[model samples]
Target: MDYGEPTKLVFSLQDPKPVLCMNGDVKVTVEPNGRRKHWDYEVTGSFVQRACAVRSRAGHVVAQIGVKGMLAGKDFYHVVVQPGYDQAFVVGVIAILDNIHGESTRC
Candidate 1:
């Protein structure tokens, strides 16, 4: 993304189970993997940049994430994932959440 960092696409993890996701001032977090394992998308701390760690059950980082802020009312998430992360799986999870919570995209 020209507005942020270069985007990298990862293959699907194929497990789009529900997870708790939060973004506070561009600090994103996702956790609670499918098998009740403690998996978390740990976003790095930065005053300007937004980065995340896609962690595994063993608390090891499996991927990295970044994002570009979207303009108001875009109805889209501008996520940038590094290698070892599954882009499809991430997007699919969001899709599932949106399906269940129809107001997620409402501005």
Candidate 2:
């Protein structure tokens, strides 16, 4: 993902040891596959809470994910995507996070 900067994340199924966690704060750039030229989105929040605010490069918060099931379970979460943002894209980002954190998709 390129937001016109040096920051990016690269992943591959072939990689023996994939990175499961971001180094520090909960910040990342996401670009959908086959859409390298498409606008990349930024996700930023507290690493501890895992509540993320998805924003466009313009700094508008298009979506936000809340830790709803903090007391119930680690697998539960809630996301609110703004009207203009694609719901599928938001959900896809959430799904990627689930995979990275081993949330609901864990075996």
Candidate 3:
């Protein structure tokens, strides 16, 4: 696929990472390389999500995913992902992050 082309990819989490493919063939994972946490993240099979800050090699960010009434009717979240970066993957990671925060706040 060429740059600027739109290709939707769904995602889910079992642990660490897992993305539902566009063709619905299998669950994919987009984790950083071993011992590299803040490096490149693979969003499409083996494609890098970010070519630089605030943008991806696949595409640019179309919209953000945030929630209102998070605390005291406040809006929160600063999710940043490009259009063709597989929203499902972004959402899945967000879910995990939220879950971790929620669990941590429990006790």
Which RMSD does model 2 reach against the true structure? 9.2
Worst 10 residues of 2 by lDDT: 9-18
Q: 78-97 in candidate 3: lDDT tens per residue?
A: 45665565665565555554
Q: Where does candidate 3 clash, by residue pair?
A: 19-28
Off by over 4 Å in 3: 1-29, 35-38, 41-63, 69-81, 103-107
Q: Per-model C-alpha lDDT, please?
A: 0.42, 0.58, 0.37
TM-score of each: 0.35, 0.57, 0.33
Per-residue lDDT tens digits for candidate 2, residues 1-107, read: 75564544442111112356443333344533544553445667742366778777688998888866654555456778999778876776667666665666432
The CA lDDT at 98 in model 2 is 68
1 versus 2: better TM-score goes to: 2
Among all windows of 10 consecutive residues in model 3, the one with the lowest summed lDDT is 45-54
TM-score of 3: 0.33
